[model samples]
Target chain A: MPSLNHYLLVAGLLFAIGLTGVVLRRNIIVVFMCLELMLSAANLTLIAFSRFYPGANGLPDIHGQMLVFFVVTVAAAEVAVGLAIIVALYRTRQTIYTDELTTLKG
Target chain B: MPLPIFWLFTVIMLFGAAAVVLLRNPVASAMSMVASFVGLAGLFVGMNAYFAGIIQILVYAGAIMVLFIFIIMLLDLNTDKKRTPKMAPILGGLGIVIAFTIQLIGVISTTPDKAMPALDLPASAASFTPGTQIAKNLSANSLPDVHLIGQSLFTEYNLPLQILGVLLLVATIGVVTLSKKQSN
Candidate 1:
């Protein structure tokens, strides 16, 4: 049987990969992919914990699953708006490179 | 055997994730992300949360990813230029070191206690009233009886749900306002 630690290690590695992406990637869409990777990592950790610690009623405390649902919902909303913003930026600037988007610099 | 299966899925997920980051084309990256999500759903099923795993496939691989691909197609981004990271190698190396150090500390701190008793499931196999007509009615549907989830959502977390609804409404309005084209 796989232990909770194994899941945690998986989550940790995923998070690290996401962090590397966020650091190395310049495209906004790829950055969003990294963000999703990070969120999924957290979700995996939560579900593992929920499975390991059943609630008083003996049900796999559905809180973690519920939380994952909400996270997915929010991620949808975020990407919808985020992609729109990126599109608008691309329209105005003609490029999606982060370094080139320096109009906000004081 | 299960360990090998799990390891295979894990390797797939990790490889897909790396492809998502490294692929030159944005569309290919999005597709790899869908592959990763599918691999993740498989892992979830391996963990015995079949419902969540299926939902992960339906919602993530099916809906959210489609939205991503649709936007990518709609935009039809040009690959005119190659972009590189802004940070120096020294800073990037420092960040990696910090991330690995945190992971190392987390792994060390959470040592499993063999003596600590494994978590127990409730003795009553079925929490609901057993084998009644009502029970039969409840279990007949294909949907994971979300009644328990609904009850918890409405009763205990009603306020949060309401807040989330309002937030979604606001975001919808914002998107509409932002995306509308202005007449010259």
Candidate 2:
């Protein structure tokens, strides 16, 4: 059986990878995808913990699963809104590269 | 979960995540994300979260990835040209990631007892009342994972569920308004 720590390690590494992508990648869409990666990593950790710690009924806690459900719903909505924003940004700016989007630079 | 299967899914997920970052083409990156999510769903299943695993595939891999690919195709995005990243940001990002990884390892190591205990399934859980009907499916040998989740969602987390529904509705409206053409 894989230890709880082992799953945590994987989740941590995955999160680190997502963070790296968010920081290093220049394309806006790729960056958004990386953000989703981070969220999934979080979900992984949550499910692992849920399985590791049994609930009062002597089964895996459903609370953590419930949280993951909420996270998924929110992520779906976020992706929809985010993609729409990206489309609108492309329409007005005709560009999606992060470096060129300098309107907010002070 | 078996040891080998755990490692297998881990490798699949991590490799796909790396590809999502390294691939220059938007469509390829999106596809990599789908692979990563599928691997993640496999991991969820290994952890005995059948419902979570199902939704992970259905929501993340299916719906969200489709949206990403559709946007990429609609935009007709060009593959990123071969260009070296600036040394400063590259080093900085790597430094942060490495530091975070080390910190996480330190925390995990300090907790010497981290192995998960064997699953403990009772003959009957209080959450699974007779009224639910699906409660009949629950046995000592089998976990009614879906039934339990549904019961909790309707009872304990009902308020939050309603709130999420409202949030989704608002997000839908927002997307429609945001995507509409500005006639100015």
Candidate 3:
């Protein structure tokens, strides 16, 4: 029975690692994946809070879980649009490296 | 309350996250993200968020990861050869250590669930619900979580549910138009 603190700690670590991945990775797709990882970390924290932090009446709070729903939906929507953009970029440039995509001027 | 199970999933999740950062190939990174999501989903179930846990696996591990794999395969990406050496690990390790220490301090000093003062207000005090039979039943917590979620979404959060539907529609159209091949 790991406590709420343990869950929060893991979620924090996940967020930190995801942030590092975003900063360090050059590939656009990999960076996108890291962003998704960060979103998952946030979702974990929300779920943990929803479970452990009961309402003052002592019933489980479902608000945080509901928010997780919205977050997951947004993450799905982001993946769809993001992957499409990545594919479009690959078609035009034949590369997915973020470093090579220096200019918007064409 | 199985501590060993909790430890097991946490290790898998952290390992997958590290692999995502370290792997050279985008495909491998995507696969590792799947592993991490699965572990997180398991934890969600352990915490009694059965609906969210299921959705995490279905939507994230299933749909999102498949989409990533599809794009990676479609691109036929060359090996990401120009790896940034050592800096990510060093900086990432430092950031993780600092964050862990801070969180541990909070965990040990204060009681768990004490940080969210906003949630501590009685539901009756809020306009959401007074201390009624329904709230009492909920306090007992015997109702299935999915059912409660469904009931709330329709009654209390209907407007937001509609908004989410619209957002999904927009995302679908945006993806299609963005990816379409322009005609010569």
Q: Model 3, residue B125: displacement in angstroms?
A: 20
Q: Which candidate comes out best when scored by lDDT?
A: 2
The candidate that achieves the highest DockQ relative to the unseen native structure = 2
The residue-by-residue lDDT of candidate 2 on B90-178, one tens digit each, is: 89999999999999999989976567767644355445565445455554457778977998899999999999999999999999999
Better of 2 and 3 by TM-score: 2
lDDT of each: 0.72, 0.89, 0.81
DockQ of candidates 1 onward, in order?
0.48, 0.82, 0.51
Candidate 3, residues B154-174: lDDT per residue as tens digits? Answer: 999999999999999999999
DockQ of 3: 0.51
Docking class of 1: acceptable
Residue-level lDDT tens digits of model 3 in A1-106: 6777788888988887787788777788889999998999999989888877775544458899899999999999999999998888888988888767878856
Lowest summed lDDT window (length 10), candidate 1 chain B:
B113-122
Q: Candidate 2: which stretches are off by over 4 Å?
A: B122-135
lDDT of 1 by residue, A1-106 (tens): 5667677777777777777777777777888888888888887877777767767755567787778767877877787788788777777787776767998899
- List the pairs of residues colliding in candidate 3: none
Can you give the lDDT of residue A35 in candidate 2?
99
